[model samples]
Target chain A: MDRNFPQELLETIQKADRAGAQAVIDAWAVGRPFHRVIPELLSPTLETFGRLWASGKDGVSLAEGYVAAKVAEDVLSRVLLDASGDGTPRPSSKGPVLVGNVEDDFHPLGRKMVAAFLRADGWEVHDLGVDVGPAQFVDRAEETGARVIGASAMMFTTAKNVAKLREEIDRRGLGNRVQLAVGGAVFKLRPELVAAFGGDGTAASALEASALFARLARRASEARGEVPA
Target chain B: MNSLERVLAALQNRSSDRPALLLNAGLYGARLTGAALKDHYRDPEVFAEGQIAVREAFQPDLLVSPFALAGLGAAFGSRLSESSRRPPNVAAFAADSAEAALRLPLPDVDSHPQVGYLRDSIRILAKRYAGEVPVIGLLASPLDLPPLIIGLEAWFDALLFQPETARALLDHLTPFFVALGRAMLHDGATALALTANLANRSILPAPVVERLGRPSLEQALAEIPGPVILHHGGCPLLPHLADFKGLPNTVGYVVDAGEDLAAARAALGPGPLLLGNLPGPTLGDLSPEDIGALCDRALSRRAADLQFILATCGADIPLDTPADRLEAIADRVHRAGRVEA
Candidate 1:
């Protein structure tokens, strides 16, 4: 809440004193939606860390950064898990969503991020994890009666798997039923490539992605007459 | 001018009769050395062998550190499958705990077996070469490192769901790198090379990179006392180039495959040396003469004022790629300037 907090965090990051920044995350982090945390706390913290890490300040190694990210994930998970344990009523008007890293695409960070955002935003989210083939993605989505399907690929070679997933979905006639969303480094490099693969939508950022899926789900619900738009 | 001296002169921005002959052998595969390096994982002999091979053959002006960034995720706690010939691939993380990542004490570079092997490699190379060649050490950036500790899925989830914590993790990770660079320099490394494949134009979005990946890279590059080479292995990566201007001591950049060398020369301005864009594997089994011609085309197209070196993207040089091919490249650089004369 102090005006100097973000500045101090930035300074600490510049000094490569991650404990100082972790102290900030400890202070400001609450089990809140990503949108709320991103603009104020998450955005500032990430912006500072990103800058400092690139600059090579105070001997920060990628291994150390990996440690810090794991730490942050623990803290966030704690908050979210605690809130869930409290049995407080979560808004449940939205339909379920299914997400997974596409086949041969071992990168799942993007998918995980979106799932977390959706969960915090009150959508029932299922993460199928990585190295999943196309049939599995659709099978899981269908079994869960999910309204949205989110897929991700971190590597360029594996991103091609998205097309296979799309083809299978069409062949199974699940294309119209499930709205497909894709994101990651591969999609970012080639924005137009997703359409050719038959993905319904793509998002550039986690926040944008969360919003995109929410909108898509709402549209799908409207088309099914399951809910008023 | 001799090959090494030509590179030196170009690095100093002095006029060179022609572009310096820069030879880079791309080293993937899982081999590493030493107990410190192999403590938690199977030490891929690739690290030691690559260093040895790169040193022996096509002794370039610089030795790019053995492939380590590809394995950072696994070192931090992800499971990785390795092969002798390919890059060690990491399976996604299951926990994705930001808190877990931050809890790790910064690894002392020499204490880590991998780092120890690396130190030994550099020491051996330096002691043997005696300043004849320079070694550029490699490491991952903050955004690049998260996926390893928490697994890719969980780390991404943290990025969206718990961004504050993710940023905190990056903040926590910075000092270890700074220490790593300092350690490498002390161990006889002449330059710091960040083979940030994640920063490739093909992977990370420009705005995201500018917002999250570049700043830390800039800070990291600044801390290295020797030259800094930012290896952007895939695509032009030009969109994010401007974010690098403030890096205090960067020596040059390893441009992506088939990038317009002239455009890269123009874009990078007159300051840094441009290393290469050899489409190593993508060119698909070309002759040494063919490879030499591509190198010539890249070097000659750039302005003489813009120092030029030659290299490949992130992949390792194929073993079948004959030594003569590399030699042919050297021969051409020597003869290239004379043709214009």
Candidate 2:
């Protein structure tokens, strides 16, 4: 609960170090951004805890895992506020990107984490939340003039919607207009599966995806002979 | 001993030395191992080969669907993307509307492309070994449908915040699900695995699960007219188990590892057969020798009861669960002094 803790929370989260980040998380767990912190920081941290429990450690318990996740969620919700509004201006020339879960998938923890990371990197991101249909994605992309679209789904059942988006893009003749990136638990198991839906690329992790989308958007501009903005 | 006798004896609460295998032939195996379905539709030989492999390997007493729960939702209108590894996924729900819900009619098992594939797979399995192994069809509990329609967040919000709308949507969706179950039963599924994750404690609030899920499940259970086998993952559904017990044709209940079997026995009380609560991480990831040792611990700790059937709490079998390890779990179960052969 040190005042200096949250300043390092994002950095600590990036390192994926649970012990290094726990004090910050425990301090911010009940403060705000619980969902965001849980998956981004707490869940991954507890993932280590889970491994320990599985390996016959006697001290750790599921309750500890739950507490860690809840606290992380709180910090996530709190830190998420004013991030976009208070965001430092876009220092990069790449176009803005929109990310979200498709209409059927409800798991937003992953998507929110990605958004937080992107916001910190100075990309104005519109997170459409979970379960937006194909039309919603197209409408949001066009409205925002977004050159890159990112979608996340944890279940294989919902991951199929990525292909539907591709079909929608082709129907609208926007194939050349935007690049699509897909990620999530399903994609983690099979990165190649994203191509079945015709995405430009797939990210297996938050960092890889944020970097991939920026590069893809820049490349899309270059293909048009525009200087890489 | 054959699987049927082993399973039947176990169900009867008699002691048995012959192990009873009950492996699922779903995408979990294909997902974990990166194996393909070989054929998703109209290939009897492909279906036969996969079934034969499982039959020879596990010699399981009961055969459950090899596909994921999202298959039915996908066949109608959901975007189902398959992977070489992991189960097929739906990117999102159709939308939160009665019209959207109705637009995706329950794909008739005999006609829908994926359902046709499953049915063909079943026919092949049955034809190849009818009396030897009973085939159980997996159906999503109606509570699961609302989430697919409105999205999980919206559905949860509806359950917690807007009770009336949730009730209305559930009222409409429940019967169609029952009809699907009846169709599968007619297609030769001796047992039905009803997965109501939305109703499970992992996701749904206990009171909401009781209020929204219990009634529809009760109706579906009555309509399906077969032994219903209920499953949940992550969170225990002890509060909802009473509702399952109250259903008319309920023959068995599967308590996940999230649940305490001793508590489940106390809740359901000795009539319906209890299957599962085998944690996959514990059972599937260890070596045969290590797993066998853990299996001994698991049996001694729980499942050493008259009414327990052997099964995983949920199906996410690790890729490393060797055929021999699979056999060892069964062998250990058979060797349990209380288990009947």
Candidate 3:
């Protein structure tokens, strides 16, 4: 949450100096344990990037957002891998989450970006991959106990299949147990469909997806009467 | 005035009683023919028949040829699936990688059915209309074709991380688009609806697009030899209007619904026609009243811009979109009445 951290990182990302951005992160993490670096600095910095991207006033393009996320992803992943004193990398405690292009929707760009951003924020992302069915999304979330499901579809037609995820969730009475986040080109182009598609929420950009999942998780926690982390 | 004359009036920014209606009722047209959407996509006769059927019902100013960008992909050897209700998604790629794509030969539009379907539809409609209406054919620009051929993720990966490789792919794909676009024009297309999403700011930064995407586009547009309308490709165009103005043969842009029309018109400087932006993909879900509100708002906003065409924007119109919803838009454009000179 330090003010000085994000501005420097933002400048590096804006200039598209990936190595410089990594160097900035490394400087911040030099004294701090790398694992704590995410919750303390990296996550908040990503939030700043998300706001800048969503604002569009400062002129952050998707390519920049993708680059920033890629940098964040590379940093967070390496730290998470090295966090354990043991060689094996333990998953982030941010909780389980699933992402996929909804059944019959094979466009992978949006979904891939979402995975990167979530992984950057230390969310344990189970990429359901493309051409995923509705039952499979819910069943995997059930099997994995993932608190959030990000369903992506590029076209309005393929996006319609996302509704089946809502149906599967409700049919299994997992509404309060898990949250559905609908997105992709369709929702971006036709935003009114977020609620129409039964999404608990939708992020404006991939960098924002992690925060959306957190909010959804908190809501699900409240519904289930669990203490918020 | 005939539909063509009205469209010409809009294109000329001439004083007119109304804004020309350029509804892209392509996928929606398949329903009118009583054939499956996939069937209509393949059979030029059925496809043109559907466009004709909709033309009878709606009386749009611009007659749309098959707007499926996938048809161009199919010409390169991609096969699509899950196209029953909507436009088919390319299930298989023409070439899975930039290397393989480079090795793939350019399709002869005259021989390839995928590309020929486009030319055939334009040929059929232009003959049927015979100067009564203008047939606008959809053509994917050179920079946009990598996503169609190699896959969206792979292409974007190469574009973002492997710049030289992406430029090489663009160099290879540029002539194919030029050839098909020129062929479509020669076959009787009044204009080409060129999908140039790569040029839009939302998709890529201006510097990146200007440096990487624009050169190929300028090259392709120079050779097409016909009027070109830059499509939003489901992205906003207002920010890039001034830049797009210089592309040869580009006379209009299909604006996104979310953009400020006044700003777009100002950016375009009254020279280029603006055709768009009813949210087409959600047409089936919106009520008639919602459709009217959107139409009424778009009409009022651009009511003064003489070079304005009222039409749908963002992805294909859902096939199941109620006919009445389209008629609702059509009726509004028709009843929009005279714009002040």
Candidate 3: segments with Cα more than 4 A from true spot: A1-6, A19-37, A80-91, A188-192, A221-229, B15-17, B95-100, B300-304, B339-341
Model 2, span A77-126: residue lDDT tens:
44555345566222343457899897567667568656755654446788
lDDT of each: 0.62, 0.62, 0.82
Report the C-alpha lDDT of model 3 over A1-229, residue by residue, as the tens digit.
5548767887877755677888888888777666666667677777887888877777677677767767877776677678656554554468999999888887887788898888877688999888899899998998998989999998878888878889999999999789999888678756888888788889888888988999999988877778654
Q: Candidate 2 overall Cα lDDT vs. reference?
A: 0.62
Write one digit per residue (lDDT tens) for candidate 3, span B1-341: 78888888887868877888987788878888788876788888999999999899888888888878876777788877656887767777888777678888888878887887878989999999978999998878888887788887667566766778888888888888888888888888888897888766777766678787787788878887889999888766877776687788889888887678788877877688888778887787789998999899989887778888888887777778889998999899989876667
The candidate maximizing TM-score is 3
CAPRI-style quality class for the chain A–B interface of candidate 1: incorrect
Q: Please give the C-alpha DockQ score of model 2.
A: 0.05
**Chain B only, TM-score of each candidate:** 0.82, 0.85, 0.95
TM-score of each: 0.59, 0.61, 0.91
True contacts kept of 3: 0.58
Superior by DockQ: candidate 2 or candidate 3: 3
Estimate, for each residue in A49-153, the C-alpha lDDT of model 1 and write its tens digit.
545554645434333344334444544555456558775343443568888888766655557656655664456788898778899988888798887888887
Ten-residue stretch with the least lDDT total in model 2 chain B? B26-35
Q: Report how closely model 1 matches the true complex, as a DockQ value.
A: 0.08
True contacts kept of each: 0.11, 0.00, 0.58
